[model samples]
Every structure is written in C-alpha cells, then in structure tokens.
Target: MRVHQLVVNFNATAQKLVNWKMIRFGFVLVVMFTLVCTVKSYTFQIPVEHDKNGEAYVTFDGTKHWLKDNKNLEYMDAQNCTVHLELFALPTEESNAYVSGWRLCPQEFDKIP
Candidate 1:
C-alpha cells in the first residue's frame, strides 16, 4: 500500500513537470508568433548625392538623411549605384527607423539584379 501511494505521488509530480514544460513551450511559441507578425521591415533604392558641404545624403519623403559613414560613401561611389535604404520597426515602436548605412536589402537581396 505504501509503495502504491509513493508511485501515485511520483506520477503526479511527473505530470506537473510535463504540464509546466508545455506551458513554457506554449508561451515561447506565442511570443515568437507575435514578433513575427508585428515586426516590419522594408527596403528601397534611393539616389545618394552630396550636399553643398560635400556630405553625402539621401532624401526620403522630403527628409534628408545624411550618410556619416565614410565606408558607405565609398561603396556608393565605387558601385555607382543608388543606395538601398533598409527600414524596420519594432513591435513596440509606432514609427519605422532606418537600419543604418547602405547595403542590399537583406530580405529581398536575391530578387534585385
């Protein structure tokens, strides 16, 4: 009788552990799905031109974002290609922010020639 009682308690503890693991796994999946759905990213090509002071910048929606990185300016001149601006927004952010410096679109680089 004592052995039966011990087995029952052990089974209950094992079931509780399995339930807790499942709850944790479910929470993780929910967070991942929420992030995948809420996170947004976009990329577009825009011409880079130097201002009167010889600083390179790109204009988007009437806003001039200066390129402060020397490497980006060099790459733009070397490739003679328009800059690819990557923009992304976090789940908590209301407005999108630039992903910094110039490069091919990470998510759609293969689609561009």
Candidate 2:
C-alpha cells in the first residue's frame, strides 16, 4: 500500500510539472503575440541609390544623403514640419539599403500626405 501511494504521489507531481510547463509556454506565447501586435507598421517611399564612393544614398524629397549599406529605413515621426528618419538593417542576404525613417523638410510641409 505504501508503494502504491508513493507511485500515485509521483504521478501527481509529474502531472503538476507538466501543467506548469504548459502554462509557462502559454504565457510566453501570449506575451509574444502582444508584442507583435503592438508594433506599428510603416511604409516608406524614398529611393535608394549608390553614390560615387560606393556608399548607399537615399533621396528624401529630392535631397540625397549617403547611408550605410544593408540598412532599412524606420519611420519615426514628423513634428513642426521636420520629418524624422530612422534606419533599419536589411533582413535578407542581399546588397540593398533602405530608409528606416524620414523627416520632411519644413518647406514642404504642405505637400505631405
């Protein structure tokens, strides 16, 4: 009878451990989903080209600026006619650079969409 009781207790403990692991996994999944959902998505329309020195260049409202190769543009925000620009790294195995963000010039504030 003691052996049977011991076996039952061990089984209960194992079941509890399994349940705890599953709950932890579920919590992780929920956290990940919340993070993914809360991230804002943005789209950029800047043109990227290479400069004479082989560095990447992006054109913002016709003004060209050199950028690091293999980066992506991240959009920050526009305030008082200044458009902010951010850069994100390339996610693929290619030789392309992208604008991570953009800041509109104060002069062109009326033309922004």
Candidate 3:
C-alpha cells in the first residue's frame, strides 16, 4: 500500500510539472508572437517629389534628402513614384539619398478587388 501511494504521488507531481512547463512555454510563445507582429522592419518608404529643377528629393523622418543618382530617377520612373527604401547599416554623407537598397512594391498589392 505504501509503495502504491508513493507511485501515485510521484505521478501527480510529474503531471503538475508537465503542466507548468506547458504553461510557461505557451506564455513565451505568446510574447514572441506579439513581438514579431508589432516590431517594425528597417525597411520603409518616404515621399519622393521633384523640385523645380527636376531634382529628386525624399522626405524621410521629417528631413528632406536630395537625391543625386540617375538610378533613382529610373526607379521613380519605373515604379510610377512608388518606392521602398531600406536603410543602410552605415549612414552616408548625402543625408537620405537613395543609395543601393531600394525595393519596388508590386502595384497589385494594394489593388482593391
């Protein structure tokens, strides 16, 4: 009888430990999923406008960055003024000039069906 009681108690304790671990794992998963959904990526877009001299300028983070690349013009022309900017690891001298990293979103992505 005593051996049976000890076995039953051990089983109960093991079950409780398993339940506690599952609860902790579920809590961690929820926190990770929330962080993934809410955290913004380094990539974002800024408005591009042409000045009177036809120079391209992008307003980023409340600062106006004048672009000086011919590729930027080609991108703007190709994307019909829609462009996505990816920030570089190191800051450049041209303020927010459109350097190498640029992504053009598909036009159909925002289309209303």
Candidate 4:
C-alpha cells in the first residue's frame, strides 16, 4: 500500500510539470504572434546634391533636410561625410507593419551646374 501511494504521487507531480510547460509554451507563441501582427511600412525620398568639394549633401522631399535623430544615421563616415542610402529610413515609426522611409542618394540627383 505504501509503495502504491508513492507511485501515484510521483505520477501526479510529473503530470503537473508537463501541464505547466505546455502553458508556458502557449504563452510564448501568443506573444510572438501579437508582435508579428503589429508592424507598419512607409516610404520617403532623400535628395542629394554635390557640394563645392564634390561631397554629397542630403535633402528630403518635404521641408526637413537634416537628420532628425542621430541614432537613425547609420553607416556614416563623418570624416568622409558619406552614408548608405538606407540610413534615411532609420527614423521611421513602425506601428501595425514595417514602415520605411525613402532616401534619394547623390546618384539620383541631377547636376545643378
């Protein structure tokens, strides 16, 4: 009788552990799904012009010309004053989907001179 009671208790403990693990896994999956569903996408254009030194000057389509957040500027070479085109999209806000900003690099601009 004593041996039988021990076996039954052990089985009940194991079952509870398995149930808790399943609940934890289900919770993780639900959180991941929610995150995947809420992202936004956007596009912007950046205009570039050649300065007197032949370096690229970045310009935006609207009134903004300079970068709003320093964190958004990636792959920048301050010494060379150059950056990748996609850096312009770094400041964008993502809500329901992945939002992207448009950037016009120097190659896309026409020579003013």
Candidate 5:
C-alpha cells in the first residue's frame, strides 16, 4: 500500500513539473532540424569566382579548372556528378548584374540549365 501511494505521488509531481510551452518549443526545433537536414542532403551550394573574357571558375577540394571559351559559364552539380552550364551571358543590365560577382547558388536550381 505504501509503494502504491508513492508511485501515485511521483506521477502527480512529474505531471506538474512538465511545461506545455517547453514541449511545443521542442517540437518546433525537431521540425526545423529535419527540414535543414533534408535540404542539405539534396542540394549543394559552393562559392565561385568570375573572370574576364567570359569565364567562371571554382576550385573545390583539390581540383582546379581554368574553364574558358565554350565551357566558360558552367556549374558542376556535385550532388549528382553532373555539369550544367551556360555558354553566354545575357546582353542586359539586370542579367549582367547578377553574374558579375562571386556568388553561391543551389546546384539543383542550376541543374536544369
């Protein structure tokens, strides 16, 4: 009878100690962690440099590619081991402005073209 009463008292105290707000916050953190992991697994973004005479360059790991001429504007999707590239830049202010500096873009978005 004493053990049974102690068990009931412990359960009551445990229930009172739990805060609903803390549980809700923990749930949100789990969701956000999952979302970040899923996206990172499927997409890769690497910083790249641009050069004159129409060229873009990236030296990831220990590889160096002096990509020029026909392979000037190119992106190698490290996720799928595929290369998607653009041969020429558009002849407009907005389009030219975007590709003028070093940048990072998800390889999947550039994978289509």
Candidate 6:
C-alpha cells in the first residue's frame, strides 16, 4: 500500500512541473511577439529621387508602409519641400514662394471638394 501511495504522489508532482513549464513558455512567446510588433510599427523609410532637370523630390512609398523623403535641396533650385514630422514644425506660409505654373488658378482653389 505504501509503494502505491508513493507512485501517486510522484505522478502528481510531475504533472505540476509540466504545467509550470508550459505557462513559462507561453509567457516568453507573448513577450517576443510584442517586441517584434512594436519595432515594425515605429520605423519607416522615405523614397527620394531627382528629376531630369536635377530637381530633388521626396515622395511616399505605399507598398513598404512608409519611406523617408530625405533630399538636401538647400543649394539646388528645386521646389522640393520637407514633409514635416511634427505638427508645429510645418510651414505657415499661405502659398509657396518657389512654386510656379499656377498664376491663373481660381481664388477658391483651397475649398474642399
């Protein structure tokens, strides 16, 4: 009878150990998944290119989430404008000084469609 009781106790102990290990493994998997998702969401790339007239421009890439438009056109006579990252850093000007080809545009051009 004593030998049978010992065998039952050992089985119960082994089951508890297995459950504990499974819980720990599940927690680790959740943490790893969270880390990967956060990293992917935070960072994005901008696409930059130059035209035949040597004008640099920054455009968005829809396929790769988002891409950076990093083109240093400070010296060049390009109409490329910086897409502001912060809300307060955006240009306050009503119209761009370097822009052209819109001389005859209607006064209510900014009205929403």
**Count of residue pairs whose backbone atoms collide, per candidate:** 0, 14, 0, 14, 0, 4
| 1-113 per-residue lDDT for model 1 (tens digits) | 99999999999999999999999999999999976654333333565655576655666656666656433332233334445453332233222233454443334555656
Q: Model 2: per-residue lDDT, tens digit, 14-105?
A: 99999999999999999999766543322244545665666566677556655554444434334444455554333432355556563444
Better of 4 and 6 by lDDT: 4
Off by over 4 Å in 1: 41-56, 69-113
From the highest lDDT down, the ranking of the candidates is 2, 3, 1, 5, 4, 6
Q: Against the true structure, what is every candidate's RMSD? A: 12.3, 8.5, 10.7, 15.8, 11.8, 16.2
Residue 23, model 4, lDDT: 100
Q: Model 4: what TM-score?
A: 0.39
Clashes of 4: 14
Local distance difference test scores for all models: 0.56, 0.59, 0.56, 0.48, 0.52, 0.42
lDDT of 4 at 12: 100
lDDT of 6 by residue, 7-91 (tens): 9999999999999999999999999998777545434434333446534333432321111243222221123322222111113
Best candidate, TM-score: 2
* Tens-digit per-residue lDDT, 16-104, candidate 3: 99999999999999999976654333234554566676666666535555665433322343545444443332233444444333434
Score residue 109 of candidate 5 by CA lDDT: 61
lDDT of 3 at 113: 58
Models 1 onward score TM values of 0.41, 0.52, 0.39, 0.39, 0.32, 0.37
Which tens-of-lDDT digit does each residue in 17-58 have in candidate 4? Answer: 999999999999999886555322123444444445443335
RMSD of 5: 11.8
Q: Once all C-alphas are superposed, what RMSD does model 2 give against the true structure?
A: 8.5
Better of 2 and 6 by lDDT: 2
| Candidate 6: Cα lDDT at 29 | 97
